[model samples]
Target: MTISQLIRPAHSFRLTPVVKVASFHIGRASAFRATKTIENGAVNEAVVLPPKDKVAGSYHWDFERLLSLSLIPLTIASVVNGAHPITDLFLGVILPFHCHLGFDAMITDYYPSRRSPVLNK
Candidate 1:
């Protein structure tokens, strides 16, 4: 048998009708509301725009990962009393940064000031 016949069994596949794309697009100033049906049976929905600053632009994943990974080596050095001064220095610097990022993530997830309009500002 040929490779094409072996792979497909030839006439099994058929194409379906493609739906037309929506003419309207969501913009920055869009206000969200309940979906409403028009006389022609087309559905419409409102879009809500959130405050710009609610999404932070500056998120430092690299620095946060560095601080997290540093803890492992620093803890090991402290336990073994290896390279006392350098490890102490790194531990002092990294510990606070690690705590700050951890708490910041907790606050971002649980507290979520952005969801509350009054507190978000």
Candidate 2:
């Protein structure tokens, strides 16, 4: 028997994917509300947007910039100094923290806790 014939038996069982990507075009935003209503006059809890701290927001941006800028000098110093203990220690802490801030920003912008809480971890 041919490979195709062997793969497809006399009795063929069709299967479909759980999620199909029919098109690359982006779809309009659609809300999926629950069809069922409250049984005994109960109400859905209000989901307020987390409070924003204006002062802290500015400070946060400033810190992000500071951390990133601080890396430049440390990076140059490390290359010039050639494997010094002090430079290694500084890079060890600052580099990870810098990366962490970038990741945190990405997470906050994309999978916000208010929306995709499950993806936070």
Candidate 3:
């Protein structure tokens, strides 16, 4: 790797899979969404698990531990203080984000590339 590449901050690997899994949630909600037909007469939805991210595996455990552990202090502060603005705000946001990461991991595991790549994407 070049100096510039090495020095640059690592791109976000965590949020990517979450985004891929979350893409289906974007746009308006519809009970029966129409599929697009391609030249070969096949659906061309582009969403898929962008090949495996090797970088993410290196720090996956660390990230999950940090996020979950962080909630301890925030939760304690919020409970002890009872409705303090900063604590309440962080707890509100971080809690949901933590939950999203967990569910994303679950989706990624159960829904492999060989199966429904759409949802696992």
Residue 75 error for model 1, in Å? Answer: 0.8
Question: What residue pairs are clashing in model 2?
Answer: none
lDDT of 2 by residue, 55-108 (tens): 868988999999999999999999998999999999999999999999999998
Error of 1 at 11 (Å): 99
After superposition on all C-alphas, the RMSD of every candidate to the true structure, in Å, is 15.7, 11.6, 25.7
Pick by lDDT: which candidate is best? 2
Model 3 bad stretches (over 4 Å): 1-56
Query: How would you encode candidate 1's per-residue C-alpha lDDT over 2-67 as one tens digit per residue?
Result: 887678754575564476666886665545665553234325755556778733644576677877
Name model 1 segments beyond 4 Å from true: 1-59, 114-121
Best first by TM-score, ranked = 2, 3, 1
lDDT of 3 by residue, 42-96 (tens): 3776556678887868697678888899999998888888889899888888899
Please report the candidate that would top TM-score against the real structure: 2
For candidate 2, the per-residue lDDT at 25 reads 48
Worst 10 residues of 1 by lDDT: 34-43
